[model samples]
Target: MAQTTAVSSTHRLWIGAQAWALRRLSAFSRAPRTAPHLETGTRGEREALFHLRRLGYTIVAHRWRTPKLRGDVDLVAGHGHTLCIVEVKTRTRRDAVPAELAVDPDKQRILRRLARAYLHRLPPRAREAPVRFDVISIYLESSPTSTPAPSIQLNIELNQGAFGWA
Candidate 1:
């Protein structure tokens, strides 16, 4: 009888441990959805990263911002002999305005200033490399509900040397 009780206690402890582990795993796996704009931006950046990698650009920084600088660069990527400062714009089908239109002349000026700051901080080798401004626009479309997992179709456009230093 004592042996049976000991085995039952051990079994209960094992079950309890399993339940705890499962809870932790679920918490880890399930990331809460962010606000629509934030989610769109994150998804755009991710897609941009993949696209840049495929084109053989090494990513140097993401969302690079400094307290001294007034603006941020979405991505800093390096190709063979050039450095690219990228701005990422994401828009859902519901958005009336196109993504590229958002980067106006004012925004281009800010990006140029930020790029200067970024270059100043880089090592001599990278600083000496030619710099180009790029814009990556991603249009997102929601998938039909019949699919098991929610998905988005992305239409990406990469504009290289979209703007130049002033």
Candidate 2:
């Protein structure tokens, strides 16, 4: 016997979500609000971090804040002697732009600075370890109808000698 779930009587989601999104998009299309937009991104980032940990990375931070720049690195993890500073971007297939495309030059510069800050904050023994910058992009074929996991695609673009100079 297989487990079957009965459809709930009250299940109108898109109608509600569309209205919410429309209201949000309309209200701040001019000045732009940061808080609400981050809600969706945070969920995706957490999911990405989960997947990364499953594949053997030890997570160090989720959203490490800094005074100079206010942004997140999504997931920071370590593997063996290498300290991996990962930038996670998640997107659906419907979007023409891919997730990794989110990390632009400005974003890269900030991430680098944050990585340095993170290193600086670490204890002396940990700070001596090698640091690498990795960009992990997750593309999901996600929709309101799916109970199963998204068709997750990961593209890991790592700058091998990221902090070799320093």
Candidate 3:
């Protein structure tokens, strides 16, 4: 049990390290702010991506930044049959507002626009491939453990094969 706890702690720290590296790279590229919320979002995205992989998704791209949209797709993935363009939104808790509600209709529209642009960039065959838009919400309901407080659970929901668009 002690070993298991140690391993879990190590894994969390490693995840933090990975986020730190990404933040550093983005900084070097002269990107915008790397606030704690950004780190939290990135971390949540990574966790969501891992869950998708475990459930049989092949990640093709990540953090695909664009100028016109000025946004990012947390993960571009495929699940054997259809290409999945995923939007990840992370929240620390589910208080009056839930995590899934963060991706508003306007945000979905932006995602659709970017998804079309992404499809246009592919070859004809690839462009014609079946595609889907999905939203993965990562709800982290725990406080930082530099100190101890209450326990928080993580919830990852994949709105798989989300068919409609704005």
Best by lDDT: 1
Candidate 2 residue lDDT tens string, 33-90 = 5675464465457556655554556778887878877676667887666787888766
Clashing pairs in 2: none
lDDT of each residue in 1-166, candidate 3, tens digit only: 0001123545556655765676457546755658989778877887787666656677899988678775777799987767889988888877687666677877777778888888878889898777788888888888567656665578887777553564
- Candidate 2 Cα lDDT to native: 0.62
RMSD of each: 16.2, 11.8, 7.9
Q: Alpha-carbon error at 29 in model 2, in Å?
A: 27
Where does candidate 1 clash, by residue pair? Answer: none
| Displacement of the residue 136 alpha carbon in candidate 1, Å | 0.5
Candidate 2: deviation at residue 84, Å?
1.0
What TM-score would you give candidate 1 relative to the actual structure? 0.74
lDDT of 3 at 29: 70
Q: Please give each candidate's TM-score.
A: 0.74, 0.62, 0.72
TM-score of 3: 0.72
Error of 2 at 92 (Å): 2.0
Model 3, CA-based lDDT: 0.74
RMSD from true fold, candidate 3 = 7.9
Better of 2 and 3 by lDDT: 3
Query: Residue 114's C-alpha lDDT in candidate 1?
Result: 88
Model 1 scores a C-alpha lDDT of 0.77
